[model samples]
Target: MQQIIKFFLRNKTFLLYVFLLFIAVVFTIQSHSYHKSKFINSANYVTGGIYNSVNNLSLYFNLESQNLLLQEENARLHSLLSTPNYSTSLSFISDSIYSGISYKFTPAQVIKNSYSVKNNILLINRGKRDSIKQDFGVITPKGLLGIVDQRSNKFATVLSILNTNIKISAQLKNTNHFGSLMWDTKSPQVVQLNEISKIAPLKKGDTIVTSGRSVIFPKGIPVGTIQDFRLDSAENFYTIDVKLFNDMTNIEYVYIIENVDKTEINSLLKPSNE
Candidate 1:
């Protein structure tokens, strides 16, 4: 107590001056309209800055959730666009069963991806629990990516189009000339399209898309644009170089597409000679 009194006594003159200065400033602001307005403006500017900073921080933390929601919305939109058109040859019951072809799109995050290998595989954070299954076509908003190859209850592996074991049916966007899409382990952004008839009109920068001849993906899903083309060894077909729309190495989110009519389609396509 004695030490405190000694310190306060020593600084009392300076402290008194500081206190009087604060009071004088407040009185001056209250007495002058311009000063009061300036003080209110300064206080508002500071508080507004603080509030903006806090709001930005909150938005930054919510980005992941917002991204996921956007991905899901994109998947839904793609699913609607990819829905198939059924044929008119089926009976009423079959038509009812087939009912304007359906698709199930499950959004997944790419937890791991590989582009340097011949048989590259991508791992995703969706699996059987999410209805992701083997042979499900995977894609992004830009274009096709790959197919799901293996799965557990909570995770799945995708066989990238860059893999040697994969062959996707693709067609020219301007015509019905279709072929098999494969990768030669040469480039991450390019793949090979073979079995296209050499007589088919193709040009540089022509677009390619899925054929929908198979049950994996519906027709018109973009594959890539033709970068170049040349006749195959037998000279009967052209082997095309396609620059893929998706950059395989930079994939983050994808949609797993399940053909709802796959089982029925496969059953109808099976050979009956046995």
Candidate 2:
């Protein structure tokens, strides 16, 4: 401290000049409206540029949070818009509410996903705490993502649609024909739906979607478009290549569907087998 005092005493002349210059600028701005206006404008310009650069730097790190927020909003909208009206107990595909099935979506973030492996799986950052659980169907806004295979309090693992073990009931849109959705394990973009009846009308671009044949997923959730089709050697069913609506390799967020009456549905099936 004493050394610093000595140094300041030695350079007091320069310091005094710097102090005087600061006083002169303040006085000039105070005395003249034009000078004050110019000073304020210059300060604003410099500070504005600084703040903008800082905001951009911070935004680059906050993209994941923004993405999750968007997914949450989408899920909320789906809760309202896509929810089926359950009225009749007979048909599953009712534009009105139907008694056979009901579901709600839980938005989730994909912290890890594997598409190249033969048994593909996705680890999502939503779990029992968020009402996500095993057997829950996962989907993005574009299409079906997969099925939840396991869960903890704060995380869930999904058997991705790209997995060879992944099988879900699906059907052609605008028709009652149903098939089994399966992945070939060769490409993440394509999956096959087998057992579509030969007599059902198969168009080049017909949409495929969840069939509600089982309780895993609600009917009419988009699967993909028919890319190509041909009868197997058995000639009893159509093997169709469906171009998936969701890009599995690039998924970041998804919605977990919890069938509202899954237990009741499963119990009824159990009694039939017994």
Candidate 3:
């Protein structure tokens, strides 16, 4: 206590001067309208900045929830768009009989993704319990991702487009020309489209999409854009390189697509001798 008193006494002259300066500044601001306005503006500016920082921090912490909500909304939108009678004014109807909806979409999160192997696979946070099944098409907002190949009670595996063993039926946009889409294991960003007829018009940057020839994916789902093309050794078909829109290595959210009429279609195509 004695040491503290001694220190305060020694610095009392300077402390007094500081206190007087603060009082003088306050008086000057209160006495002058311009000074008062400037002081108030400065105070407001500081408080506003503090509030904005707090708000931004809150938003950052809430990002995961916001993203989940967006994913669900996107799934709903995709379901509506896949319907044959979809309209802007139409409200979503879950009943297939009433809406004539042939496809259903379910949003899922990629719990694990692999793109560095010859046959890449993705694991999603949904399974048989969620109605996910083999041959269900998977996609992102930008492009196609994969198809579900296996499922358990609470999880499912997808055969990624990057896999060498998987082949998707794809066609050039605005035309009937279609080919088989496969991965060459060279680059994750590109896939190869084989068996496209040489007579079909080919151009760089031509958009490619699902052919809808199979019961897996509906027609017109985006695949990618043509990056390059060349004739095969036989000169009968063009082998085109496609630049995928989805970054396979960085996928997070996806939508699983179910074809409602798939069973009926498959049944009709079965061999009669069987």
- The RMSD of every model to the true structure, in order and in angstroms, is 22.2, 21.1, 22.1
**Candidate order by TM-score, highest to lowest?**
3, 1, 2
Q: In candidate 2, which residue pairs get closer than 3 Å at backbone N, Cα or C atoms, i.e. clash?
A: 85-96, 85-97, 85-98, 86-97, 86-98, 87-97, 87-98
lDDT of 3 at 240: 97
Q: What would the TM-scores of all predictions be? A: 0.66, 0.65, 0.67
State which candidate, 2 or 3, has the greater lDDT. Answer: 3
Best by lDDT: 3
Candidate 2, residue 210: how far the Cα is off, in Å = 0.4
* Predicted candidate 1 versus true structure: per-residue lDDT over 58-172, tens digit per residue: 5565567557756865797777767786443354454545565467788777666689977777767676778776789999867899887766566666778887777899999
Clashes of each: 0, 7, 0
TM-score for predicted model 3 compared with the true structure:
0.67
lDDT of candidates 1 onward, in order: 0.78, 0.76, 0.79
Instruction: Give the true-structure RMSD of model 3.
Output: 22.1
Please write out the lDDT profile of model 2 over residues 1-274, one tens digit for every residue: 9999999999999999999999888865543321122232211234434533554565556578557756765797667766687344545565656544478878776766578887776767676678776688888867888887665556666777887676899998898899899887768889999999989999989999999988988989989999999999999999999999776766666788889988988888785743
TM-score of 1: 0.66
Q: What local lDDT score does residue 111 receive in model 1, on the 0 to 100 scale?
A: 62
Worst 10 residues of 2 by lDDT: 34-43
